[model samples]
Target: MDPLLAKIEYWILDCVENEYSYLWEIRSVIEQRLVDVDKAKLDEYLCMGLSSVLTQGYVQAFAGIDFRGEEQLVPGFSISTSFIEQHKKAWQAGVEVDQDIRFLISDTGFEHYRQGCPPEYFS
Candidate 1:
């Protein structure tokens, strides 16, 4: 992995993990994908896909640390319940972000594999 990409991925995961306690798996997937990101690809994704808020948060988290991007990487976290609620509300509002988040659930209902969230916790 390019050093710049690795650093960026770590900052992303670190920020996201603060908000979404159950996203270690997702972070791992992102890290793997980042290994292929060169400077040009990183810039392209930033311009198109990723929000600048993420980078800002990372910079804030590590104040005084020099990062690759000109934008400050202020660390940020999403409120877990609020994060879930935003998706729920978006789905309800007929947003195409995805099918109703509620519909994504299986009958079991979020069996907790993580220590922070116990089984059937969302309800």
Candidate 2:
């Protein structure tokens, strides 16, 4: 693979790790602040966090790639639309699943992100 692609992959892995760590922190906060935090609340937070990653991590990261003349960092010089679509589907599916299960799956997804292919890989 191209060195730039490798860098982008590494960046994505780091971003995903940070995102999961953030989620764990949020879960801890909820557990402490509220005796019983609703599943909906957790899911809502997860959605927001993932949205931030998509917008800030992917989109904003793309800007830096362009500035640095590493357009290949993202395929087609942009965040692949198909990757975004898959992510949207995954997010929707997560929201539709049971809350406890969703949290579990999300945690697993974080690990998968760190070690496995990014959504763009599938795209």
Candidate 3:
């Protein structure tokens, strides 16, 4: 993995561990840690990293929670890898992700993270 991507992946895993899985919250922590990075560049890298994990089934995306704090349904659109890619493009074009999406590390993701994210995934 790229050094920045590696850091982002670890930070994301950490966030999931801490139960702070919302995109905004994860971004805030990463942005704070990478203060010297340009915002645009950071967003680009973040999108890429997120897309990769989601596509690989290492992370699951959820949306559309009801007022009762129950997960009504997983937003089918947001769960796709293409959605994440499009989101990254939109963000780069200055259009923000307007959905209320949250992420969770899948069991595979936890195993991968615990295994230090082996070099195969790095490629």
48-77 per-residue lDDT for model 3 (tens digits): 666667777667776644323654335332
Q: What is the lDDT of candidate 1?
A: 0.33
lDDT of 1 by residue, 20-76 (tens): 322223333444556765644443433222233233332122222222232232235
For lDDT, the strongest prediction is: 3
TM-score leader:
3
Better of 2 and 3 by TM-score: 3
Model 2 worst lDDT run, 10 consecutive residues: 96-105
How would you encode candidate 2's per-residue C-alpha lDDT over 55-101 as one tens digit per residue?
43332222221233432222222233353445446565765322111
Selected candidate, larger TM-score, 1 vs 2: 2
Instruction: Name model 1 segments beyond 4 Å from true.
Output: 21-123
- Report how far off residue 66 is in candidate 2 (Å): 31
